[model samples]
Target: MRAVLQRVSEASVTINGKLHSEIQDGLLVLLGITHNDTDEDIEYLVGKITNMRIFSDEAGLMNKSVADVQGSILVVSQFTLHAATKKGNRPSFIAAARPDQAIPLYEKFLFRLESTGTVAVKAGVFGADMKVRLLNDGPVTIVLDSKDKF
Candidate 1:
């Protein structure tokens, strides 16, 4: 599992021109899953995402986690994150997990995240063409890959 975390003041997802979900003062998570991803990957990402200290504190230092700020989270599945482009101009999605294998992990991620009870969570429709909009807070963004940790 891999995730791109963007700290945002506000974010929303729209599908077919209809708003699906939205959040305020949170992270817009663009998640990608691979064939080998397991529950362990989900666990690791969730732990880090919820606890990572990226938000600023009153002292103007980056010391507060999303939970500390009582922010929400907006997750969106993005298979394209794993696109491979070394060989040619067209990116190859061979690294991205197929729906048969990825959907379960995707749902697990959301469930695991919500279980934390530390912040509100929302998600875009899996596999749908989603339009996402956000006002990036501090323009802070971080990328994490579960494969890197273990």
Candidate 2:
């Protein structure tokens, strides 16, 4: 699993011109799953995301976690994160998990994030055509991969 976490002041997802979900002062997470990903990966990422000290403190230092700021989170499925581009110009998605394998894990990740109970959690519809909009707070973005924790 891989995730791109963007600290956003506001974010929203639209599907078919209808608002699906939105958040304020939160993290907008683009998540990707592979066939090898398991519950352990979900656990690790959730722990890291919720506790990440990217939010600024009163002294203007990035010393506060999202929970400390009482922010929300918006998770969106992004299979393209696994795209392989070493070959031809066209990117290949061979590393991405199929919907049957990915959907459940995606749901589980969202559930785990919400279960923390410290912040509100919203999500974009999996496999849907979603238009995401966000004002990236501090323009702070972080990339995490379950395979690279070591």
Candidate 3:
């Protein structure tokens, strides 16, 4: 599993000109699931995301976690995170989990995240063609890959 976490002042997702979900003063998380991802991966990432100290404190230092600030999350599934481009000009998605295997895990991840009562979570339609818009806060973005935690 991989996630690109962008702290945003506001964020929304639209599908077919209809707004699906939106949030304010939160994080926009672009999540990717690979074939080998498991429940442990979900546990690790969700825990990290909720507790990540990206938000700022009153002293102007980045010391507050999402949990601390009572922020929201706009989670979106992005299978392209695992794209492989080693051999050719075109990127290959062979490392990404197929929809059959990925959807269940993705849903489980959302459920797990919602269990953390500190956040107000919103999500984009899985596997849909989504248009996401956001005003990035602090221009702060972080990339996390479960496979690279060592």
Candidate 4:
């Protein structure tokens, strides 16, 4: 499992010209999954993202977590995050989990994030062609990988 977290003032996901999900003053997370990913990955990321202090406080210091600031979250499934581009011009998606294996984990990740109670969480439909829009806040972005913990 992996995630690219972007702090945003606003974000939304649209499918077929219909808005699917949106949030304000929160983080927009693009999540990727692998076949080996488990519930532990979900647990780890949920904890880290909710507690991450990327938001600034009254002192102008980045001292506030999403929980502290009561911010929302918009999560989008992005298997392309795992694309392997080493060999040639065309990126290989062999490293990414197939939809059968990824969908369940993706849903679980979204559920876990929403359970954090830090903010009002929304999500883009899995396996859908989505158009995402965001107003990045501070342009603060972070990448996380479950494989790197060791």
Ranking by lDDT: 1, 2, 3, 4
TM for every model, in the order presented, reads 0.98, 0.99, 0.98, 0.97
Total clashing pairs in model 1: 0
lDDT of 3 at 99: 96
Off by over 4 Å in 3: none
1-150 per-residue lDDT for model 3 (tens digits): 999999999999999999999999989999999999999999999988999999999998999998789899999999999999889799999999999999999999999999978798999989999999999999999999888889
The lDDT, on a scale of 0 to 1, for candidate 1 is 0.97
Reference-based TM-score, model 4: 0.97
**What's the residue-level lDDT of 78 in candidate 2?**
100
Cα lDDT listed for each candidate: 0.97, 0.96, 0.95, 0.91
How much lDDT does candidate 4 score?
Answer: 0.91
> Per-residue lDDT for 28-140 in model 1, tens only?
99999998999999999999999999999999999999999999999999999999999979999999999999999999999999999999999998999999999999889
Evaluate model 1: give its TM-score: 0.98
